[model samples]
Target: MAATGTARTAVDSVMAQLSALEDPKMRAVNERHGDDYGVNLSRLRAVAKELKTQHTLSVQLWQSGDTAARLLALLICRPKSFEQDELDAMLRESRSPKVQDWLVNYVVKKSPHAEELRLRWLSDPDPVAASAGWALTSERVSKSPEGVDLSELLDAIEVDMRDAPDRLQWAMNTCLAQIGIAHPEFRNRAIGIGERLEVLKDYPTPPNCTSPYAPIWIAEIVRRQAGE
Candidate 1:
């Protein structure tokens, strides 16, 4: 009972703090991405820094079902401590795109069980879970492409990217770009796959930001790497 009380008190305090930090404009932007939060990411990181790593408190915060709180939980949580099933459940519960992305990148990516979960999530019927899996795949493709079959990935992307749901499409696109950027042998082929599919080609991009269009994105990144 004492532990429960302490956890409850900590959760309430943090939730109240998050509520106080809400920004209307940030909330509007987040809402457009299927999330609802106003606490700026930098401010959120500051909050996490103060709390430090508290795995139990992070679990409690995660159970609260608030997007900002969940983000905070991820920041403070011990990444390697979670069981694979627990991470799976968390991803399933993550309806907010921001939460899902952060959970996969910040926590799951650092876990020891990353590969196991990545393989399972890749074949998951749920697109969101599959997207997280693809995000992991992209990480491996760029950093550790030893066992990754680049050609097979391209074949899959060529067939599926155009019809994939928003989240999965974005992840696959990242993988495609990673292949092109990291592997000289596959650069042309990756660009070819991207061009043929034309995914995100027409997507509006803000001024000065690189477009997500793969062929252009690949060439620009490769150019910058060679001191263009």
Candidate 2:
């Protein structure tokens, strides 16, 4: 509704047409491209040039069941120029929790408003949010210029560790071990958590291991932490 005015009519028309399309595959593919979406790569540039505003009617074309469309929307959606309310609105409508986490994770890295998004996400009811929180914590501790306190993040993560999905738990613990080995400052902290998880005692997660990353993930962390 608050979309830019100059392109209103054209965008509305496009939104209407795209929304009506029933072809799942084309919608999915086009959604990924966003403004750049076109049968030809050149058409993307032309379309983007024609549609200068951030929010457009054509984006609704993403409502189809096409996974590509949903993914593309996430790829093209930008929070830099968006107001806080707008960002919140976009996350709410996204429907895809992964995309929401992707948006949150993306903004936290580049936007000055990272803290706001982080706090909101940390408190989110979604398990993906908690899992994303762990991932974000790992990234911040590993890469943040300001340097994060691992103890604080670990404490928060451990709060709901029992409830996270197995895959998320595996990733969360694996990330912790990686940080421990890479950041000596947090080595003790990482080792403490990793050893306690006893990841190596169990089988590795399937694909990555005989079973899951849990076994080896936990074991490796404990071993490295103990200086073995």
Candidate 3:
């Protein structure tokens, strides 16, 4: 009966693990900070691996069946480092705002898929995606010998300001403050957007849109551009 007892113990362990799934609130926070899951990668990968077989949990988390769960799953899955094709699938499939935030934020700082990012910035339906696209463009311009063309980027910003979501508009404006200053071509555009800072002071402003030191930066840019 020792073999039978071992089987029961293993079954019980699996059942207990299943029972430990987090409640909704905890899961939401986990989804929010999913990219920060630096330590939980192995466990998350194991769970994701099992879901590919079982198909229940992965379906609930990644598909339209449950947005929060889907978001958490992507957030959890994101840190494990997948192939470019896998990442493309996730980007194509994911529609969660949280996931969008993570993906766009990733593009701003990383360079693995440079051309793809530029394309997405130009054409993505989601404002966050577009905002991230421009932010990534600004980053490329800042570093590349192309020297960060202001006219096109500013025109894109103007389009976003008029037609895109406020979140994306705010993100574009914020990135403008930080990244657009290096090039002289964007000086007039920078001042023009900076002039509108007063209109964007309302509550719905995206985080980091208005730098605490933006006025100082604007003055500096204006002075430098004018040869003062």
Q: Quick one: best lDDT, which candidate?
A: 1
2 versus 3: better TM-score goes to: 2
lDDT of 2 by residue, 9-69 (tens): 6545554543454356654665664422223323333444554434443254344433334
C-alpha local distance difference test of each model: 0.93, 0.52, 0.52
| TM-score of every prediction relative to native | 0.96, 0.56, 0.52
For TM-score, candidate 1 versus 3, the one ahead is 1
- Expressed as tens digits, the lDDT of each residue in 1-228 for candidate 3 is 997676556434433443355355655566675431222334544654654433233333454334444443543343324444545555565555556665545432443665565666555786656665665665566566264456766666655554457656666665566554665566556667656554253435446453423334556665677799
Measured with C-alpha atoms, the lDDT of residue 169 in candidate 2 is: 71
Give a tens-digit lDDT track for model 1, residues 115-155. 99989998688999999989999999998888888899888
On TM-score, the leading prediction is 1
- Minimum summed lDDT over a 10-residue window in model 2 is located at 35-44
- Candidate 3: C-alpha lDDT: 0.52
